[model samples]
Target: MTIKRITFLQELLGLFGLQERVHLAWISSAEAQKFVEVVTAFTEKIKSLGPNPLPAYRDAPRAALAAAAH
Candidate 1:
């Protein structure tokens, strides 16, 4: 169930050409170290991916918000 949702989001991100910006991980609450490791690895991965190509979306929060508010 969770995997389906994650895969769906991953595919959706890919459609927008922002796949690297989203990551999925299954870390148990008891595994704090694993959580840290997953986050660190994901951070490094994102760093390697460099700047996002879709900067306009990031800069135009007002537009997005206004559209959503309406």
Candidate 2:
């Protein structure tokens, strides 16, 4: 069940081209160093990927205004 939730999140993020940007990790409280390493690696990965390409929500003011009219 836990894995299913993780997979669902991965797939959902993939729809927005963000699968690589999201991750799930399990680190014990005693594993602080491991946590730091994981965070550093993920940070570098994101840096290399550059900026997000998804369109800004600000561009949808027309849609939002239409919905608010209802």
- The Cα local distance difference test for each model comes to 0.82, 0.81
Error of 1 at 59 (Å): 6.8
Worst 10 residues of 1 by lDDT: 61-70
RMSD (Cα, Å) of model 2: 6.5
Error of 1 at 67 (Å): 28
lDDT for 40 in candidate 2 is: 96
Off by over 4 Å in 1: 56-70
lDDT computed for candidate 2: 0.81
* After superposition, candidate 2 runs with Cα above 4 Å error: 55-70
Top lDDT: which candidate number?
1
Question: lDDT by residue for model 2 over 1-70, one digit each (tens)?
Answer: 7778888998999886788887778899999999999999999999998876454446656664575474
Give one digit per residue, the lDDT tens place, for model 1 in 1-70: 9889878888889877787688888899999999999999999988888877567568866775676563
